[model samples]
Structure formats: C-alpha cells, structure tokens
Target: MSVMTISEALHEALRGEMLRDPKVFTIGEECGFDGLYGVSTDLEKEFGDKRVIATPISEAGFVGMSVGAAMRGMRPVAELMYIDFIGVCMDQIINQAAKMCYMTGGQVSVPMVLRLPMGSGRRNAGQHSQNLESLLTHIPGLKIVAPITPCDAKGMLTAAIRDDDPVVMLEHKLCYNIRGEVPDGDYTVPFGKAAVRREGTDVTLIGWSRQVLNALEAAEILEKEGISAEVVDIRSLVPLDFDTIAASVSKTGRAVVAQECVNRGGYGGEISAQISENLFGALKAPVVRIGAKNIVPPFAHTLEDAFFPNTADIAAAVRKMMREEGSACG
Candidate 1:
C-alpha cells in the first residue's frame, strides 16, 4: 500500500497501463508538467511524445480523433479538461463512439476513457463548474464511472481503460489533492458495485463522486443526533448497482439521494424513483433528494455554498426523512 493523492494515483495507474500494453496511450491539453493537475507530468519523460501526445485547443477534433483511434483497435485515454465542455464534442461521444459497436454489429469497439473534471466548490463559476453526469446517463452505450478516492481512481481507471466501450470517467475538480491509501500494484475495481461506506437502519443516503463524501460526512453528523444513516456510493452511474441500493433501502425503510447537480432533472431522480417503484411497500417516507439549485454556479464561495448541496443539506434531508417516516408510521 502507498499513500498518495488522487492525482499521483492516476499518474501511476496510467503509467502501469502504458507499460503493460503498448496500445494504451494518453492525449490532452498540457497534461504534462504544468498541465491542469500534472497527472501525466512525469509520464511523458518515461513514454516520450508519441505515447503522451498533447493536442491543440480543440475538444471536437481530439475527441473525434480518439474515437477514430479506438475504432482502429487502439485504447485512447483522452482528457477533456472540464465536464462543462462536453457539449463541444457531444456528437462524437453520443453518435459515433457510444454507438459504434452496436452500430457495426459488434465488429468495432470504441475502447476509450474520457477524463472529465466536474462539479463545483472551487469557485470555478458556472462555465467551469457543472455536474453534467445526468446528461450522459440518459444516453445508452456510454459507461460512466466517478471515483471518490485515490484507490478507487486508480482501480476504476484501470478497468475503464480495459473495457471495450466508451467510458466517461468524471473526476470531481475538488478531489484532486485528496490523500488516501492506494495499492502499489495493479488492480481493477469492477463497475456497477455500490460501496456501503456506513451501515444503518434509520435511513439510506445514496450519492456518488464528491457528493458521496458529503453523504459520509452527513452520516457522522446524523449519528450524533440519534439518526443512523447508511452511505452508499454509486461509483458507476451507467451500470447502476440497484440491487445493493434496494437491499439498503429495504433494511432502512427510508432514503435520501444527493447529487451535486441541480435538483431539477438531476440523476438523483432516477435513483429516488427506483426506490419508490421497487420498494414502495417498504418505504416509510417519500425518498428525499438533495442537490444544487437550478441556477448556475456562482463564483463567490458563499453563493456557491448556497447553490451546491453539502453535509448540512444532506443531514437536514435525512432528518426530514426520519420525521416523515415517523409521521407515516403514525
């Protein structure tokens, strides 16, 4: 085991994959040295330019080029810098890369990982900070993975690189420097498996990415108020682990889903609806959802705090569910 930040762990993971397979290569804007996070800084020194290629300021062109490379049997990990720019290359992702295998009768596979830095809390304002994972989930054939820790970032990136599909890896902009224990060797964390960070019988708190950390933090705060909240991290949004979610909701009889995106048309609605549809009988209260406001993220820390959901918001939601559960019982 090695203690490292999420950035270092990603660097190590990419290096390991590049060493294992010659087909694995990376491309992004200024990813080396002074790149956004320096995740591939030292990688170029080891692998040279052909493998660690950098591109011009063209999301559409580079993303399309990566999709083409993937179709030609090369594994490409293309970094899009920010998730807010997903619109710049939506057609390439949605029409070409995502549907290539199905469109070609399984003859061609788009094995690519798009590293997207997302979510607010860094004062990046509306243009730079947005949790757009909900949009990608609506589209079929695209696998989305959001890792929370250094270990998870490394393992899931490994799996995403190996998968024969177009994978969107959403990296929360605030999680880059988070330190955690990561394995020094090679490993892969399979998709669709939800990790239960806490066990409780009062309510289930479901989230992913940085929101999951808020869930865990809220769990601790709730515990102080005699509320036992269980935290479930839906690591892979596309291949959802509803079985685990269902079981947890069944055991708790209440649920609170959180998302960093706005509440309106957010992805949390899907999880909340599933609980209502499948476990309606077991539910003691309506599934509560906590998320950012519908307005754009503000640059001010105070306004951004108000716009995005946090530990306090999550705890309040769980408390409301507990009260509602009591009322339903009565």
Candidate 2:
C-alpha cells in the first residue's frame, strides 16, 4: 500500500488504463502539454498523439467525437477542464452520449468517460467554480461518480474507463490535495457502492467528493461533543448506494446530507428525500441538509466561505438533530 494525493491517484489510474488498453484514449484542451491540472501531464508523451488527441476549445465537438469513437469500438476519456463549462457541450452529452445506447436498442454502447474538476474553493469565483454533478445526473443513461478518497479516485476512474456506458466522473477541486492510502496495484472499485468513512451511532452524515473531507471533520467534532455521527462517502451519485445510506440512517435515526452545490434542487435534496421516503418511520429527526447557499459563488474569499458549507455548519446541524431527540450532548 502507498499513500497518495487524490490527483496523483487519478493520474496513476489514467496511465494504467492507457497502458492496459490500446483503444483507450484521452482528448481535451491542455492535455497534450501538461493537462489543465497536470492530471494528464506526460500522458501524451507516453501514449502518443494517436491515443492522446488534443482538441480545440470545443467541448461539443470532442464529446461528439468520443461518442463516435465509442460506437466504433474504442474507449475515450474526454476532459472538461472545469465542470462549469459542461453547459457548452450539453447537446452532445445529454443528447448523444447519454441516449445512444438506449436509443439504439442496445445495438451500440458509448464506452466513454467525461472527466472534469468541480466545486468551489481557491476563490475561483462564479464562472470557474460550480457543482453541477446534479445537472449531469438528472439525465438518463449516464453513470456519475464523485469519488472522495485517493483509493476511490483511482478505483472508480478505472471502473469508469472500463464501463460499457458513458460515465461522468466529477473530481472535487479541493480533494486533489487530500492524501489517503491506496493499493499500489490495479483495482476497480464498483460504481454505486458507498463507503463508510467514519461510523457512529447518533446521526448519519452523507457526502461525496470534497464534502467528504468536510463530513469527516464534522464527524471528529461531533465525537468531541459526545455525539456519535456516521460519515458516509457516497462515491457514486447516479447509481447511488441508497442501501448504505438507509442502513446508516436506520441505525442512527437521523440523517444529514451535505454537498458543495447550492441548496435548491441540488443532489443533496434528492438524497435527503430518498432517506425520508425509505426510512421515514425509522428517523427520529427530520432529514436535514448542509449545502452552499443558493447563489453564484462569490469572488471574494470571505464571501465564498459564507456561501460554502463547512465543518461548523455540519456539526451544528447534527447537534440540533440530536438535541431534538434529547440525546446526551456537550
């Protein structure tokens, strides 16, 4: 086993997949040189121009190309530097890549991966930073994976690359630096499986990507406050692991869903609703959510901090729920 940052793990996975499959290719802006975040650095050199095709600043064209390639018996990884830019290529993603398999009656499959950096932090502001995984997941036939730890980042990316369908892999910008232990050899973590990052008995806190780190921090604080809070990292969103979430909520009788996206219509809302519907009678407290305020991410650091959900907000939500139950609290 070796410890690595999430970014490094992702890079390693991409490299491994490229070496394993001759048909596997990656194409996107800035990938040929150093990649946007260095995720594809040295990849072009290793794989050559034929496999690592760099394109113009045209998300639609390249995404369409990926779809075409997949139909022609090739697996492609298309990188969109920032997920906020996915709107530029919505037609190809929603109309072509996502619908091809079902629309063709299983005659064709789009074996492709859309890799993008998402979430707010580093003061990138409104245009550059947005948590739009919910938007992608809203569509049909697209598998979404929001990995939190280095291990999941490596495993899930490998899984997405090998999947028979198109997969939207959303990497949290803030999680790039977060370090964790990962196996040195090749491994594929199954999509739709949720990992219990930290287990407790009072409240279940669910998160993915960068928010998983925040959830872990909140769990530590909750422990100090004498509240046993279970933190679950929902690595996959589209094929969500509702079983793990329901089990955790059943044991704790409370749920707190957290995410970097804004509160309104965000993925957290869907997750909370699922818990409420499936485990309504088991819940001692209403399912609450911790999310960014519904507004464009602010440019200023101070304002951004206010707009984003943090450990303090998560801890407060858990405490309030525990209080309603008359559970022992600090």
Candidate 3:
C-alpha cells in the first residue's frame, strides 16, 4: 500500500505498465518532458525519447498517428493536453479510432488510452476549462472512465491500457493533487463498477471524477441537516453501471445526479432519465440534476465559483427534492 495523489498514482500506473508490457508507450505534448500536470514527469529519462515520444502541437495529426499505431498492435497512451482540444481531433477519435474495429468486423482493435485533463476551478477561462464528458459519452465505440480516487486513477488506467478498445480517461484538473490510499504494484479496477462512498436511505448522490468529491462533501453537509444522502462514485460513463445506480436509487427512493458541465443537455440528464425509466416504480420523486450554470465558464475566481456547482448546491438540491416530495429531511 502507498499514499499517493491522483497525479502520482497515474504516473506510477503508466510507469508500471510500461515496465510490464513492451508494446506500451506514451505520446503527447510535453509528456516526454514533464507532462501537462506532472503525471508523466521523469518518464522520458527512464524510457528514452523513442518510447516517450513527444509530438508537434497538432492534435489531429498525433491522435491520428496514435490510432494508426494502435491498429498496428502498439499500445499507445495519447494525452490530449486539455479536454477542450477534443474538437480539433474529433474526426480522428470519433470516426477513425472508434469505428475502425466495428467497421472491420472485429478484425482490428484500437487498444489505446486517451488521457484528457478536464474541469474548471483553475480559472482557465471558457476555452480550457470546459467539461465535455457528456459529449464524449454520446459517441459510440468509446469507453470513458473518470476515476475520482487515486486508487481508481491508477488501477483503471492499467485496465484501460489492457482493454482491447479505445478508452477515454476523463481526468479532472482539480483532482490531480488530492491524496488517497493506493494499492502498490500492478492492479486494475474493472470499468462499469460504481463505488459507494457512503450508505444512506434518504437519497442517492451520483457523480463522477471531481464531482464525486463534491457529492461526498455534500453528503457530509446533508447528514448534519438530518438528511441521509448516499454517495455513489460513478467511476465510468461508457460502460455505465446503471444497475448499481438503480440499486442505490431504489433503496433511497430518490436520487440527485450531478455533472461539472453546464446544465443544459449535460450528462446528468441521461442519468436522471435512466433512473426515472428503470426505477420509476420505486422512485418517490423525480430525480434532480445539479450542473454548472448554462453559460460559458467565467475566468474570474469569484465568477468561476458561481458558474460551477458546489457542495452547497448539491445539498440544497437534495433538500429541495425531499421537501417538494413531502419526504422527511432526516
């Protein structure tokens, strides 16, 4: 066992995987140097320049190259510096990497991992701070995982690299430095399994990545007000564990889904719909969704705080849901 931040855990996972597998290699801007968030630092020194390849500042070109490399049996971990840059490589990701295997009748697999650092709270403005996991989830043939804990950040990356499919790792910028316990050595947390951070009977708080941390904090606040809120860390979105969400929502009789993205047409809408459709009979009230304000994220620190949803927003949503449904706060 080891105490590690999410950044360190990811670095350890990549290092461990590269040591274990000959096909594994990483490529991205500055990855061969110190990486965008320090997760890939010191790797080039250990692996050499060829394996820890750095590319030109071209998202489309490098990502296309990575897809071609994956098709040729090389396991590449390609990092797109920001989630906001996805638009520049949409064709390479959505059309080529995602559709190649199915279009070829399972004859080929793009066994690559795309590490995209996302979310706000860093005052990166609208261009660099957008949360687009909701948009990515809509695409087919892509596996998306957003692990909040250092353990999952490490374990799931291992699993993503090993899986014979293209996986998109939605790593939040704010979560990189948060410390947590991580199992030492090689380990993989299976995708589609949601972790229950806290057990409660009143309502379920479902979130992924850094939003899970917000949910946990909200649960603590809700507890003080006599409301028991279960915190469900949705580890992955592509192979979503709707069953686990259903179980929690069923037990609690209510649910509140959250996302760091804007409220309009965000991923929370999909989760809320799923619960309403499958667990409709068990639901005591309509599932509430908490999301950032439907507007471009502001650059100012205070405006950014107001633009995004926080722990208070989550707790208040839960309170509103219970109150409107005539349910007890406790």
In order of appearance, the predictions have TM-scores of: 0.98, 0.97, 0.98
Per-residue alpha-carbon lDDT of model 2 for 1-330, expressed as tens digits? Answer: 999988889999999999999989999987898686778879888879988888889888898899899999999999998998898899999999999999999999999999989888779999888898888879999999988888888999999999999999998777788889999999999998899988899889999887888888988988887888899998899899999998999999989999889889899999999888889999888999888898999999999999999989999998887786676433
By TM-score, how accurate is candidate 2? 0.97
lDDT of each candidate versus the true structure: 0.91, 0.89, 0.92
Instruction: Find the candidate with the highest lDDT and give its number.
Output: 3
Off by over 4 Å in 2: 327-330
lDDT by residue for model 3 (1-330), tens: 899999999999999999999899999987877798998889999999888989888999889989999999999999988999999999999999999999999999999999999999889999999999888899899999999889999999999999999999999998899999999888899998889999999999999888888899999988999999899988889899998999999899999998999989998899999888899999988889899999998999999999999899999898888777875434
Model 1: how far residue 113 lies from native, Å? 0.5
Clashes per model (N, Cα, C within 3 A): 0, 0, 0
Pairs with backbone N, CA or C atoms under 3 Å apart (clashes), candidate 1:
none
Mind giving the per-residue lDDT tens digits that candidate 1 earns over 4-92?
99988888888899999999999887755435876897788888888888888789998999999999989999997889988989999
**Model 1 C-alpha lDDT versus the unseen true structure:** 0.91
Ordered list by lDDT, greatest first:
3, 1, 2
Q: Give the TM-score of candidate 1.
A: 0.98
Error of 2 at 272 (Å): 0.9
Among all windows of ten consecutive residues in candidate 1, which has the lowest summed lDDT? 29-38
Task: Give the poorly placed runs of model 1, Cα more than 4 Å off.
Answer: 328-330
